[model samples]
Target: MTRPIQINNHPFRFLLYLEWILLAISVITSVLPHPSPRFASRFPELAILNLTIFGLMGLRLPTSNNLVKIIYTACGISLIFITGLFGGRADRLFPFLYIILVIRSCLIFQLPGRLSVTFVSFTLFLTTLLYRIPRYPLPPQAQEKFRFFTLSLALVFGLSLVFVLILMNTVLSERESREKLAIANEKLRQYALRIENQATLEERNRIAREIHDSLGHSLTALNLQLETALKLYQANPDKAQSFLARAKELGSKALQDVRQSVSTMRSNPLQDKSLAQAIDILAEDFQRSNNILLNRQINLEYSLSTEVNTAIYRIIQESLTNISKHARATEVNLEIIINRGSLYITIQDNGRGFDLEQNTTGFGLQSMRDRALSLGGKFTINSAFGCGCQITVDIPLGRLIS
Candidate 1:
């Protein structure tokens, strides 16, 4: 059989120990060598009653429900009243009453419940006063002393109530701070996940474009050359040999192109240059390789943080790949600008455009939006049937660019 693990050390337990020490001191002070015989007789009973209530309070400290707490409080208050009545020293019980009031205030309750507890405590105090003055025989000189004692006890109770309220306020404030921190951490995790997914999608789009541009074009040319070689193999043997050689050359070029594409895809550009320079290099490469007329316009010379630069570069790369694959047009324009502490990027294509609503499952546009949103940015795509597509991204400076 396994024994239960004992991990009893905690801050709340330490506080309870401190409270017990304080209660012991209060009991010792109230009981040691009282001048009045009646008060002396009641001291032991008062101490035992206080100890019992303190034990019950320790048990109830972890509870938060109003009904259960009210029950415990009522039991403790009834014991206090009974001890006072039997001991015939109402003034001696005021300290216990004050402590009970403080415990009652700590209960998790609405305004109505708090007011109800306050009313019950006040009623008990008044009832104790009425029970004590007439029944306990005293001289006129002793009565003045009793009045002063009652006033002092009342002041102590008021101060104790204020202290309890302040403690409760501090507990509530700490709890709120913890909750806010948890929510902020959850949001950050979600943002990071979105960025990861966008990066994956961009990698896939680049691979697809490479297959279409290099491999597909090469295979088409090889098929055409083979067909021509078959038609002229006997009539023009030399021409047939030349056609086969050209087909072999195309095949070799395709393999080289695939190797180069894979090598460049694996390189990390953001490690060496600023985001602006990286984007300029990408635009330059696209213009050099593709037959489509590429017009690049960068209107700003702003610096971005390393992570923001990488995200931006990936978005632009994905956009260019989409244009190369689907946008069958003659011209494409790319623009980058910084306005009001935000990095804005626009990629426009003068190609046949598809409906944004109809192509919602297309990963390219979704990936672009996810990339922008991950960096605390806004992404918008505007296009319609027969018109070209324009993607606009604006990332906040405070969140990403800074």
Candidate 2:
């Protein structure tokens, strides 16, 4: 069974109320005195029948079933024909029934269907006028006046129908546009939420890498120094004291690394330093902490943005940390140069390298790769067992500055 139309929830509740008011007036007008006494009393009953059919059709309203709509419309047309032929009534208010039919058609149909229904209603109205004209015979003296009045009434009704069609179409089109805009806003909200989640995850991973590369390495070296100092305490007093000093230094370095990592979380890694100055500090710290020989050649002629500076600095720092922790390299080469319209960076180490495929998923390597890619650059690492590893990055300069 079809569900009943919920009038309270309808968008056009005002239109429905207007329909009721107009139909009530029409029924009241149909019962008044007329020239033809034969059907004067029955006209009220016919008007009541029309109202009953309208009420019945309203129950089946807001439906998608084409057959149901067509049947209801036919019933309305049939009532119009009966009123004109048998009742001999084509009064001024009668055209309102056809207008009501057009209103209902607007609710049920699209543009093409609406136009078709309006055309049919107008045509039926003309037919009703012609059919009732002969029955209500005007005298020859008033015939011209009656003809002019009839033509004026028809023209007015026609214009009213056109105005209603345009108004209903405009209202429906605006409602549809608002609905589509609401849907688009919801989709954009979901997309922004997803982007926020992804950024949060990446930040957490970066913090993890920073902690591992800085505090982790310093603590490990501190532990080894303490062990060495314990072994030499009794055997050699001077060496034991020196080792103890180095252990204290390592402990201080670990604390400093923690503070730096905290600062990095709150702001950019380089703070206010130039990329060249930041790299120099990183190189000095690495050499002071390890017994590895480092060679550097940096050539940056143009000023770089904070994002580009951070990317370059972090990539170099991560590389140095990885080499100190696992590479077992004695010598490392670092180079940064700008050529044509691109920045190129290369880091090579004479370390006992592991298989590249096996270690590609390491946090340090992934972090460097993410930084390079974020700068719209390419990062490639090549390594083999017992051979040195080389990492090269190339970033375009044109779009970066622009």
TM-score: which candidate is best? Answer: 2
| Candidate 2 ranges with C-alpha deviation above 4 Å | 1-5, 27-39, 43-47, 63-68, 83-92, 136-138, 205-244, 253-264, 267-271, 399-402
Clashes of each: 0, 0
- lDDT tens readout by residue for model 1, 1-402: 222111252223544565566556555655566677766645566656665675556544424555666776676667666655554333465555545455445534544555566656666766766666656668989988988887786667656665665675577567658879999999999999999999888778656644554455456556656777898899999988888887787578667667766777433445588776777766665554445787877765555677677678778877887776677767888888878888788999998988987975666666677778889899998887789888899987777645
How many clashes (backbone atoms < 3 Å, residues ≥3 apart in a chain or on different chains) does model 1 have? Answer: 0
- Among these predictions, the greatest lDDT belongs to 2
Q: Which digits, one per residue and each the tens of the lDDT, describe model 2 over residues 94-169?
A: 6787787788788777888789888888888788777656566678868988788779977988999999999999
lDDT of each: 0.66, 0.78
Q: What is the lDDT, from 0 to 100, of the residue 153 in candidate 1? A: 66
Off by over 4 Å in 1: 1-13, 22-36, 41-50, 60-66, 83-107, 110-112, 134-145, 198-202, 209-216, 219-236, 266-402
The residue pairs found clashing in candidate 1 are none
How does model 1 score by TM-score? 0.53
TM-score of each: 0.53, 0.85
